[model samples]
Target: MTELLGIPPQLLFGQLLLGLINGSFYAVLSLGLAVIFGMLNVINFAHGALYMTGAFVAWLLLSYLGIPYWAALVLAPLVVGLLGILLERTMLSRLYKLDHLYGLLLTFGLALIIEGLFRNAYGVSGQPYPIPSWLQGGFNLGFMFLPVYRGWVVLASIVICFGTWFLIERTRLGSYLRAAVENPQLVRAFGINVPLMMTLTYGGAVALAGFAGVLAAPIYQVNPLMGQQMIIVVFAIVVIGGLGSIMGSIVTGLGVGVIEGLAKTFYPEGSATVVFVLMAIVLLLRPHGLFGRTRT
Candidate 1:
């Protein structure tokens, strides 16, 4: 009954929570996009398709193989990651020296093919994915009744996001990864298999997308078209945060989600367009993005 800013606490927190959940998906998805672009200089337009494949893989695992959510969480990403590696080796490798647009177009075409195949096999209708039994309940946090699964999404997202940042920024392997991106010949001279590293990097980046898809399976219906809906917004988030900036993607994702949630609370009509509007403003003032580094 009590109101904050003339809105019920339930309504406010509910939308805020919803926003954060969506943001979790954005963080993970955008992180994958950033990693791929940062290290490989490839704009993976099929990322959405890859994400969709992840959810489908999880659903198939459960429906046919009797695999549970916990296993699917790990298995789905691995399955898709291997697939990604195959794509990189067989197809993407050919375009490394070509214009970035060539790679984008190739992946975009691949996205269309993948989406069409899934759409034909599984109609447009959404299939429900039940939440795991252990994570079914809610916790009453004084003002809000936070669902266990939703809270898990937020926590897992934060840990994964920060953990990824640490991995790429702090670890020796990460240093090698960065070095290879900066100077592949130099890295190769140091006895690193640069090409192999690139293949693995792409696979790993795509695995992040697949992992996010698995995280989203229960919250959103497992559907063929689900990725298409989220990918554009996610691309926007990646650009706004800064291209190729790992920390920027994570922090901006969480922050933008909260901002969007607040806008939804205060001005519901503008929630959908708010992010783009911010994108325009940020671009006008900062061409490299809020977190992107400017090259000399």
Candidate 2:
């Protein structure tokens, strides 16, 4: 077997696959964070808790309520998104006129509260979530055994990320969203319901996080800590991708996943820090991020 740079193809490809899978989760989660941050100017630290709620909701539906995975995929996000709307209406909306840091602090407190509640209910152990029967097997590609579920996750996330981007970048509704973000008073003057739009945007952002949670349940042990574990890395991804660039969040997310995988293969000790290192480099090179554009 030919080796490249002292690494075997089999191992290399396997790590790359792992990286891609990690990237899928990162892309979806970070995109959600970007959406909420860009439009609402709120740093939603509760995002990870929402994600955990998503997984737990799906698990609860299946184990206790007899709901299927497919149904959960649709319903879990809706439930979570509705909660997000409530949070916005009752809590987050009040912070809009305050410093953006206030929103971040409020969300952080919410995260701690949610995670603590889950921990009290479920304890620290992870619960296993069965993979849907239809996607239980793997394909024998010439070079790799590609798990059907994993492959589907990658494809699905890509479709969703781009679809969201298209909706925001191309659609008329997106134009209004952008306008509202820039000047809510002006948008409302045109008869657009800016408050309602803000509610929907927050819901949409939380929905994305919930969707990611559903996808992750099958792959990871559905635990209260799962979202917390991933969210830190995701925050790093958001920072590196540029706080306000949707495309930047998606691209940098996947790219960093790949790099992290390679780092694990070559220098396992460095894998954890590689993302921060990359962020440092990106910050040094492009302070506003790779794709961020000035609004004016």
Candidate 3:
């Protein structure tokens, strides 16, 4: 077996693949966070809880309603998105006029409530979600074996990320969204329903979180605390990429994932702390984040 830097090529490639898979999740989750913060200006602390809800919804559909994984992919997000709309209309909208910290605190409280309810309903143990028959195998690719489901995740994440970027950066609707974010009063004067747009944007952002959760259900055990474990790392990704910067979130997420993977291979002791260390370094050197623009 060929060796690179004294590490077996297979082992190296395997870790890279794992890192890419993790990056996919990070990109999707962070993209959602960026969208919400960019337009709504509200830091959604409950995002991880919503993500956990998405996976649980998928699990419920499969276990109770006899829904297949394929169908749940389409349905779960919609269900969660609707829930998000309700939360926004009833709860989040009330916080817009207050300080950003108020919004954060409210969402954090909501997260605690949601997580607590789910924890009470379902024990802490992770429940297995069987992979669909069509995606139950792997292919050998010269250097490493690639699982079909994992490959699907990477492809789907890339497609979704680019598609979102295009919608926000290219389309007329996107232009309106950006305009409203800049000056809601002006956009409203032009007869656009700014409030509705905010609601929809928030819902869409949460839906993205739900979609990521569905994707994760098959990979990670469906457990109440799953989102809690990932949310902090994702927040770090957002900070490193620049808060509210869509492109920054996607690129930083993938790059950091690969870096973390490499760290695991070269220095196991630092692997877990690498992302935080990177976060600290980025804060010290470029507080606005790599892609964030400094406001004069």
Candidate 4:
């Protein structure tokens, strides 16, 4: 076995692969946060809970409804997205005109409510989600064994991340979304439904979180607190990437994930704190974030 920097090639590659997997989740989740904050100007504190909901939804669809994994992937996001729309209609929509803190508090309370309900129903234990049969194997590279599911995750995340970037940066509806946020009165005067656009944008952003949840269901146990654990890391990613910069979110999330993985390889003690430490460093150096514009 070849050794690099006193570590076996296999071990090094394995950690890097693990880092890429973590980065995938970070990219997708933070992208959603970026979208929501950019358009709605509301920080969605309940995003993690919504992510947990997506996983649970996938679990329920499988356990009780006998729905397969492939179908659940599509259905779970839609289910959660609809719920998001409902939440916006009844609650979140009302907060747009108020202080941003109100939106944060409402989302925080919603997160607690959702997590509590799931705990009451499912307890703190995590439920198992089986890997899809098609993805049940591994590839032996020269240096390491790569699981098919992990590869799928990385590929799917890349596709989704770039696809979303293209949608927002190069598409028609996306233009309207940007325009509406910039000048709702102007967009509305042109016969575009700005309010409806906001609702859809919020739902879409929440759905992205749900989509990531579905991707994670098989990798992580389906538990109520799962989202809580991941969300903090994601928030760190968002800050590192910049609050509303879509490309920044994707790039930073992946970069941080890989950096954290490397930290685990060289210094195990700092692996957990690596992201936060980077966050602090980034804050000290560039308070608006890596891609954020400085306010005058």
Structural similarity to truth (TM-score) of each candidate: 0.97, 0.97, 0.97, 0.98
In candidate 4, what are the lDDT values of residues 108-225, reduced to their tens digit? 9999999999999999999999999999899998879999999999999999999999999899999999888788999999999888889888888888888889999999999999
lDDT tens per residue, model 3, 1-296: 33637899888888888889999999999999999988888999899999999999999999999999999988998988999999999999998878889999999999999999999999899988889999989999987999999999999889999899999989999999999988899999999999899999999999988999999999999999998999999999999999899999999989888888888788979978899999999999999899886632
> What tens digits encode model 1's per-residue C-alpha lDDT throughout 1-296?
33636888988898999999988888998999999989998989999999999999999999999999999999999999999999999999999989899999999999999899999999999988999999999999888899999999999888989999999999999999999988899999989999999999999999988888888999999888999998888899889988998988998888789888988999999999888998899899988888899743
User: Which residue pairs collide, candidate 1?
Assistant: none
Score candidate 3 by TM-score against the native.
Answer: 0.97
Candidate number with the higher lDDT (1 or 4): 4
lDDT of 3 at 115: 90
Off by over 4 Å in 2: 1-4
Report the Cα lDDT for candidate 4. 0.92
Instruction: State each model's CA lDDT, in order.
Output: 0.91, 0.92, 0.91, 0.92
lDDT of 4 at 30: 95
